[model samples]
Target: MQIVDRIRETFRENAAMLREIENKADAFFGKKNLQTSLMQSITMLTTRWVKMPVTP
Candidate 1:
């Protein structure tokens, strides 16, 4: 019975750790996606600016 309790405790700890890791991964990817979107927008704006004729 003691060993069973220990095993259960270990599983709970592992599950908690897994959840924390998944949350961090989600946050990291979310930031990465936002950065990529911003970069794409900047690139598009620069391309448009380059194609526009300059007026004095």
Candidate 2:
């Protein structure tokens, strides 16, 4: 339960960080730029998840 709670909290923090990044990207660039960069970021994150190592 404690580990689950910590994971939930970490996810919430990450969501907030992602929102801030999107806002900053949109402000400095534009919707199109934000879309492109966000797609790239998603791809990178997906790749990382796919390649994540498993511990025994």
After superposition, candidate 1 runs with Cα above 4 Å error: 31-56
The deviation in Å at residue 9 for candidate 1 is 0.2
Candidate 2, residues 7-48, lDDT tens digits: the string is: 999999999999999888788899898789889999999999
Q: In model 1, state the lDDT of residue 9.
A: 100
Q: For every model shown, what is its TM-score relative to the native structure? A: 0.53, 0.57
| lDDT for position 48 in model 2 | 100
Q: Give candidate 2's whole-model lDDT.
A: 0.94
Candidate 1, run of 10 with poorest lDDT: 25-34
Q: Candidate 2, 16: how far from true, in Å?
A: 0.4
lDDT of each: 0.90, 0.94
Residue 50 shift from truth in candidate 1, angstroms? 44
Residues 1-56, candidate 1: write the lDDT tens digits: 99999999999999999999878876977867867988999999999999999999
Poorly placed runs, candidate 2 (over 4 Å): 36-56
